[model samples]
Target: MSPARVGRVAVLAAALGALAGAGAGWWVDPGGDGTRPALPATAAAGRPSSFAGADASWRGASPGLDAAHAAPSDLAARRTGAPRGAVGTPELQALLRAPPSALRASLKTAMRHRDQGGWLYARALARQCVLLEMTTLHEGTAGLAPVDLNQPLAQRVSAWREQLAAGCAQLQPEELREAMNVPAAASGTSATPGTLDGADPLIQLMDRPAPPGSAAARERLAAILNRADPLMLSELGPALLQREGEAFVFDGRRLAGEDERRALEAATMLLPCALGLACDERDERVWGPCVMTGDCRHATREEAVLAATDADAGLDAGPAAPDRRAAVRAWVERLREAVLARDVDRFLRPPG
Candidate 1:
């Protein structure tokens, strides 16, 4: 086949395989957590052992998962019906977009290309077998209630590590060494330190189910999102509409100032409007539940203000304290006006 055809074939196969697994509730977790307690340790391998060791082994499993015939047959014979709403669909793709900040972007990218043969495998397996471990965690949490939107992002990171270790266990030392690129002197060192930049997407896809007839293609479909910054979801989704049901009123109209403008501009840089702002001691931090989502929101506002002031001051000592404080006070007033008016646009517009 032509190169283009070959590439299309790979994509098609990967999609089918992934879809099939989603339907069957099968995932590959590279972490050695044994997501499938009933299945044999080497079931994912699905073939004879190529090698074995504490940290590495190779099961000559067929890369072609044959989801069309195999997946449905196995799913039917299992006897246990799927959970209340267990129909498999492409859900992971929805999560590919970036979240709150650059850190989340970095993680999304890193997870996309993780080695499925390692820790990524375990995570996938666990998700596939249990189907609800992570899902439940997400749905169980309060706020941002999108079935599994509340899932702790930190837990996903932990699961990624687990998947990596488990997949690594099935490889031989030489294979592990080669996969991790560990030199003789650096036997125990991790080769993935900086390589995470390239591995994120692979990990993301692998963690999801492999589409039918595309196991081999899915395994080989390795495309790196080389861009330094991936797409941010906050920028793509619906705009944040204020729910306060009030408006800012100045002399004759709504009260608004440069501070409100700057604050709105700053809002774009933040996560869901659901994480509003709160007064933390003397500083304004992201709004949480207690002190503000007290846990997640930090001195983000203070930090931003400091950064803006420092940038404005340049090398100078900055204007007198009273002058700076006056500016902040004015900003506070504008913010109040903007919030009351629910002028999300004016709020986000940068102050001159």
Candidate 2:
């Protein structure tokens, strides 16, 4: 077989192996034979129940579960007068700009201290490290010819599986979102091609005057959000990333897991509405005014990213809703093409 053929086999084997890993992670009810409770998120996390630095007082980082303790909103989190100081700092900018492999050593460092825990940034960075590790599995396993057919594939597969299982053990869905910077909600889906070129929310937001002035606005928004929901925008990331995966399948590759598929549609809506990003004409269908897009709502509705009022009132997920899955699917296809084309500049911009 050619090297490409061998690599394809390795990737397939890795996916199947992950299924086994997933199954093993589920817990059997203590008394109920085959049933389990719906609320066992921690039990379902399938790794250590305790989050790293979960107990520590972290500084200058975006709020984690730990942030709920005092004030992630507290200015004291910073020493110098930086708004977020170290927390908001993109520690991985250098690595993200580098190849995917460069993340491995840093991931190892995060994983080692993941439990011992130190900085809130380290804990937050570890969450991204876990995700990066998952990507590397795909990148590393995507190609390779096993020199000896006699070698048990488990040797190659088990180690990586174990690593991912441990790293993501007790990983919450929200942590996944902030790491990717994918929106949990957006302001509108009616974004036209012309508007998206300049109207991408992040781009638009960046163009505004610097904070303290503008930052003061966000702080005010944060206070309103704390009253409305103290945990602001954490869960939004995972929902967006998962649903976006369905929209982003490429070269026959796709994302899976029931937890991932659940709430995909609602989360998809949030992208254009909450994040102020462009909607590909396709996603234009998957979300909109609640009356029209109600059918597109993910059935399970268990893992909500942002609350309904928050998504609608704050982010504006309600607007022209979908006619069919074809909408989001089409948008995803366009995104896949862009990524394959290495259109980094166009990632947040609406696809053609």
Candidate 3:
């Protein structure tokens, strides 16, 4: 194989490794003091693990729209399905009723005790509210066709966010710094860091103005493509690519222009996979819809997507098929090659 092909293969291997087990233990709690039980060694190694110790029954239950309409206190009391010592009805009520400053303090306290189920759930809910607000803001500003916010899922997300934000209009600015344990002096005089800038160095690189198609820019692009998590790359890739007339511009610079067809193809293929990974990983962003809709029956986002589009559609709750897995691997490799070569035309092209 050529050197370029070899590198692409290496990138695919790394991505697969990441998907398999590199960060699989996020849900694991070795101490097992009832906050969460430790997964078995096999489970931690990327095998299908039973949710025996966790109150995961909540995932399969559909609390329905009426549940959404119920008072927060009533829902909290009825949904005692969280693990022991998870946030209780009283605490939930307090959080819902707390003033903005008090809520911020409560959330900060929750951050400290995230190992406990109740605190973790509270933090997760708060994060989801922020994510929904961000999504709404992005949709409004991106100059793209906005999604129907009136859709059931969209409505649920909006309602959940509005309910949460009633007490806490926004998260405290220092939350991320405190969570990441960054020194106060390092962040300088800014009370709030730029969201993307603070989160990842790669994002900072993307935000900077670089000469179009320069060697340094290509190198930076290559590093981002190769090093990014598959989920991150899949989501961020399209945002970086903008269609300008017949050509596409990446990061606001006109690189080699690609037609719209290929860009759409790439998005169509990669986005669902990213969504699946997000839901499978139980990401906090998905928690809002899951909790609000109370239709967490789908274990994977792919399943959720299927059910949304076609109510009768069903997916096996087992591992993905070998061919589907192979397609994802090939897609990632293609993306890596496109980035390394600085060729937008090949970015989402399927491997020959």
Candidate 4:
């Protein structure tokens, strides 16, 4: 076989292998039987989860569970300023315990690619911690009324900011880039046009912004995205570096290999939600009468960079509301159905 043919075979084999593993994993849902949930009657609607009442402090950058006691008074306090002799506080002690220490170590590893953006790293760390927090909160409040989403979000945000300031203050661009070994120059090289630039009927309808003066109406947009199932990027490995060719279909045309397809899908599935979350959280916590665009908000220079990429890529620029999370959740159920029914077509489409 030619090198291209070999490459194609390798890609197909890898995808099939991965699909098998994923299939097995889903089949053995340790938590519950692998029954997928039903889709809702109507897709959730509206602007990015309305910042008017959304919790700003719940963003991914807020300090992990440690921020509560690390700086009891001000979530922005430097690590050096933490209560020097009061390390005995239960929360502080808990933060020092093996679990949080393990979490910290895990963070260092996860942040190995820090140069991508400190804010990005910070946001990721905060999100993981919040998920942990939310999980714990749910367990603790089993059978309780609705969570005090506002308070937890505020506390999480405060803690996240403090932790980010303390942990990331010394991270200069060059040092971060060197640590991650991602060439700062290479970020400029990817040449694929974004999703909306193509001819997909669904995407085309999603290309434009929501109608004007719909800020309040669009508030739930972010939450809608947030509630979506997260895309597992590992599925696209074999296709990453392959050349775009007639065999590869993306947007509407045959592009290249799996890499671009994966990128396009991610932009379609995740970018918009990330942007909506960032915007909604920022509006709820930082600004007043904020518009949808980043320019109308108070993001730091770093966050501004992230926001711009999402907006410019048009990944996050879909119809103002699609219950993206719900879509993903429903997709998960469909996957379960496919696996049970042995439906090959349901499992083989280009992701998103």
lDDT (Cα, tens digit) per residue for candidate 4, span 106-150? 244434323222222222333333322222233434332332324
> Model 1 reaches what TM-score against the true structure?
0.20
Q: Which predicted model would earn the best TM-score?
A: 3
Whole-model lDDT per candidate: 0.26, 0.26, 0.35, 0.28
Top candidate, metric lDDT: 3
Q: How do all models score by TM-score?
A: 0.20, 0.21, 0.33, 0.26
Better of 1 and 3 by lDDT: 3
220-311 per-residue lDDT for model 3 (tens digits): 55544543333333324354444445454533344442322333333333442331122332332233233332333434433332222222
Kindly list the per-residue Cα lDDT of model 2 for residues 1-352, writing each as its tens digit: 6454344344334433422322211222333443221111111110101112111212222121111222122222323322121122222211111222222333333233221111222223333333333333434342222223233322322332343344443333333332223222321133421244223232222222323324443443232222221011122222212124345322233445332243233333332222111111111111111112122232111112222222323333444222222243343334323322434333232334
For every candidate in turn, the CA RMSD to the true structure comes to 23.3, 21.4, 19.2, 22.3
**Regions more than 4 Å wrong, model 2:** 1-121, 124-159, 162-352
Of the candidates numbered 1 and 2, which has the greater lDDT value?
A: 2
**What shift in Å separates residue 333 of candidate 1 from its native position after superposition?**
2.2
Q: Where's the lowest-lDDT run of ten residues in candidate 1? A: 46-55
